[model samples]
Target chain A: MVRYKAIIAYDGTNFNGFQRQSTGRTVQEEVEKTITKMANQRVEIHGSGRTDAGVHALGQVIHFDFPYERPLEKMRFGLDTQTPDDVAVKSVEIVADDFHSRYLVKEKIYEFRVDIGKPRSPFRRFYASYFPYAVDVAKIERALPDFLGTHDFTSFCATGSSVEDKTRTIYEANVTVNEAGDELVFTFRGDGFLYKMIRIMVGTLLKIGNDRMPADSIPAIIAGKDRNLAGPTAHPEGLYLKEVRY
Target chain B: MVRYKAIIAYDGTNFNGFQRQSTGRTVQEEVEKTITKMANQRVEIHGSGRTDAGVHALGQVIHFDFPYERPLEKMRFGLDTQTPDDVAVKSVEIVADDFHSRYLVKEKIYEFRVDIGKPRSPFRRFYASYFPYAVDVAKIERALPDFLGTHDFTSFCATGSSVEDKTRTIYEANVTVNEAGDELVFTFRGDGFLYKMIRIMVGTLLKIGNDRMPADSIPAIIAGKDRNLAGPTAHPEGLYLKEVRY
Candidate 1:
């Protein structure tokens, strides 16, 4: 048996998320469908993580095992022909048998896009989150560093998550604002993230940046370890799994 | 009755065209449907020109008459709230009775996007034309000047167009290549354009740039004034009605 690892990019607007479910479409389902058509047999793919519904991805990683081998280029093109235009297998390479996509410990970088000040664009509606209110970049920048280092992110995690251990390490966090363009891109690089952790963190940052929450609310929220202590979760459409580094 | 002019933007992926049609959904149909709901009576809009199926627009101009006065912003928001996310009323203003959208003499700017030497993007498939070939930007730039000045563009116009006079003044033409990004954006500004003129021009220019046709072939093709003399018409998804200069 041969294992193949692939980097995938998806729009995620029409998808129910990256995981397979009983109903609705998912990115993993589309990939499996394409690979099955190529291999002429049922196949399953393992994704590194699960993004929520309406979330996009630039470099989500996945691995699958095939009974026989095929040229990577042929496999790539074959997958492209079968899947819809919104999903693409960006790159593929053969990997060791032990290289499991999810079990391999690695850092994941995520980007969240926000369109601010300017009117929302019809073309960008499916990709960017539109916020017409004012955003104070200085406040957001100041609060970003609070997310660095290891912490039990219980307050940032969504309620009802099956995840029991909430401790995770955030290697870096950044907030960049294109003032002229009225856009904001927040990036988070961590060893791992809990369910809806990044979205909750962004929402809390925005609340503080907009002066709805106290300037020093982040440390308190993290220490509180209560879901209700954090601000509302940001929309999923703006979140993207940007990269996975092993 | 009061006259209002609107600058609109649409993705055009789901639309049949900018004009009302009997079968498929159209940008005009959506706009009129929303306004009809607002005004409580039948109303029609006059657009600057018709965009073919699968064509997008950034600043398409349209004018219509209403039975009563309304704030421009309110009307814009109301139309947005009623229509699908793909179409947006970018701006609105009350215009004089003499202001006719289609009859006003002005220049129009059109843009064509080409994804050169890169894999097709999942998110941009509905907007950009993917040409997986190396492009010679210098060759395209050299051939562009030959297209400037007043000329009969019958060779560039799509066949079966009803317009008899194909003579149009080319105000400016520019070619820009994003070297790092492997993308090309071609802009054409003229008093007006023939049916698919910009697209045909782009295709012919690409032909020359890719060494399929001679660099000096443009002048001869324009002089020929026959539809058979020009290169193939480019796809509609890459064409955008960028702006209208009043």
Candidate 2:
């Protein structure tokens, strides 16, 4: 048996998410179905993690075992042909037999974009969130540093999370503006995340940026360990899983 | 009465292009309906041009005459609130009554994105075209200069074009890549274009980039005044009308 690790990218707009489901379309189901047709055997794709519907991903990692040894290029093209236009296998490489995408990943990066202008950009609607209210960039920037490093992110996670451990190590968290364009991108890289953690963090940050919360209150929110203490979670459309590093 | 010209943006994935159609959902129809509701008056929007179904736009220009003389911000926000999330009114401002989005525009810019990789990116599935084969960047670059300046772009347009003037001035035409990402964006700013002109140009350029067409043939394709001279028109998903300059 040969183990192959594939770098995946997908527009989750039309999908139910990454995992296989009994009904509705899914990224994993599509990939596995395509691979099954090509390999003449049922193949299961293990993804690094799951993203909600309407979210997106680039460099999302997945691993699967194929009985026959195929060239990386061939596997890539074969998978590409079988997948829908919105989901792509960006790269495929041979890996050690025991390699697993979720267990081996070192960090994951996600970007959430906000269009902070009065004029809504229709073209960017699917890729970014639009917030017409005034935002205090300085306040959000000041509060972002508090989210960096290991912390109990219970307040930032969605309620009913199955995660037993809330102490995730956030390698970095920051906000940057695309000066050429009037847009802001929030980037987060972390060892692991709870369900809807990034979206909620963005919501909390937006509240802080808009002066709804004090910049220095981030630690308190984390310490409270209460999801209700955080602001409402942002919409799913603007979030994108940019990459996963191993 | 006030004449307003707005820069618009929209995700065309769910639209049947920019024009108002009776049977299908259209960007123009959506915006027009929104304006009619806001102004309590029938409004007709004159767009710079119509885009095919599934073609996106970042800076599409449209002009409409409104009987109510409201603040630009109010009008912009009103229209934004009324329109669906897929289409957005980016900016609104007063313009000369003589100004027409189609006639008075100085230039229009459009971009086509191609993903040259083994696995297709799912996140950008609605925004880019996939090409699994390796591209010859040098050959594609060499052919760019020939497309600049004034030329009869008949061959690069669809056969059903009804426009009397096939001649258009291309101010800038080039293929540049994102420095950090595995994506290629082809931008073209021109005085005007025939129907399917940009898509045909992209198709031909893609062929040249893939070594299907010789670099020297671009000029001949333009001069031939025959649509058959160019390659197949590219998919609409990868195209975007980025901006229209007054």
Candidate 3:
């Protein structure tokens, strides 16, 4: 068997999520269906990770095996044409026979978007979370550094999560204001993430940024190790799986 | 009766057009429905002009008469709450009883957008017209001056138009490239425009920019006084009724 790796991007507006289920449209199902049609064989593709419903992806990686080999460009173009318009195989390459997308991940990055300082607009209704209240960027910037280290992120993960491991190393976290100053972007890069970790973290940071929470509230939230201690989970539509590095 | 004037804006993605239609949804119907409900009386509103289906507007003017007077702010807010998310009333005020939206208009400006130099995607599906090929901005600029002076403009008007007076004066016509240069905006300001006039003019300019027509082709097309001489009408989504000046 020959292993093939591909980078994918999707809008996620109409998708149930990145994983396949018995029903509903999904990014995984769309790509897998196209690959099956192109290769004339049922192929189960493994993604680096699963993004929640309404979460977008710009560089979600996946791997699958096939019985035969062909020109890489031909396979990529063939899959692209067959897949729906919302999902695309950005790049594809032949890899080692044993390569696995999920097991080999070294790091991941996610971005959360906040649309603020404008009248609620219909243009960004599906892509951004509109926050009408004023937020202090300096306060948010000052609070993000507290997230930059290995910690037990049980407070950030959603309740009833199945994973036993609650610890993750956050390599970098920062808040960037767009030039127009109407958008606030929270970007997180880490060794790995817990379920709904970034959204919870962003929500907590937004609370601090909006002066609802003190800037120094992070240590107590982390020390509590309780999901209820953190702020609410940000909306899924504002979250994007930005990158996965191997 | 008290005359009221409003500046309206709409996405126009779902509407049939601005004029009243028997079946499909239209801007006129949406506003009239809301106003009728607000006033509890049958009312007739006149718009500055009609916009084709799928067109957008940033500043469309309209006028109507209501028997009673209320705070302008209250009326504007009431209309906005009743309209769909894609449309809004930017401002409203009381006007002279004799004022008419269409009859008193002095000039109008329209802008058309083209998204070029990127793989076509669903994100801009309703907002812009995508053109993949390269264009010569200088060639288009050279051709625009020919549209500035008063002319019959028969070539730029759609066939089957019933207007007998085809002469119109174009005060300004220019092509602007955005800072990214990936977007080319054609802005036209004229005393008045005939049916499909701006769309056909932009189409002809685009053809010239793409090397399909010579930069000097404008004069002959105008002198021919025939709609068949001009390029095909551009897509409706890119057109916007930017402003109606009094």
lDDT of the candidates, in the order given: 0.88, 0.86, 0.87
Q: What's the CA error at residue A183 for candidate 2, in Å? A: 2.9
Candidate of highest DockQ: 2
Q: DockQ of all candidates, in order? A: 0.62, 0.68, 0.30
Model 3 error, position B109 (Å) = 3.6
Clashes in each model (backbone N, CA, C under 3 Å)? 0, 12, 0
- Which stretches in model 2 have alpha-carbon errors above 4 Å? A21-23
Task: Report the CAPRI category for model 1.
Answer: medium
lDDT of 3: 0.87
DockQ of 3: 0.30
**How does model 3 score by TM-score?**
0.86
- Native interface contacts retained, candidate 1: 0.65
lDDT of 3 by residue, B1-246 (tens): 889999888888889999999889999998988888888998888999999999998889999998899898888877776888778787899999889899999999999998773444445557677776779999999999999989998889998999999999999999899896778889999999999999899889989999999999999999999889999898998898999998
Candidate 2 or 1, higher lDDT: 1
Task: Tell me the spans in candidate 3 whose CA falls farther than 4 Å from its real position.
Answer: A1-3, A66-77, A175-182, B70-74, B171-183
Scoring only the A-chain of each prediction against the true A-chain gives TM-scores of 0.97, 0.97, 0.97
- Across B109-211, the per-residue lDDT of candidate 2 in tens digits comes to 9999987654556656678877767788888899988999999888998988788889999989888777755678999989888898988888898899889
Task: Return the candidate ranking by DockQ, descending.
Answer: 2, 1, 3
For model 1, state the Cα shift of residue B103 in Å: 1.3
Question: What tens digits encode model 2's per-residue C-alpha lDDT throughout A96-182?
Answer: 998999998889999999988657666566678877788888999999999999999989888888888899999899888886556
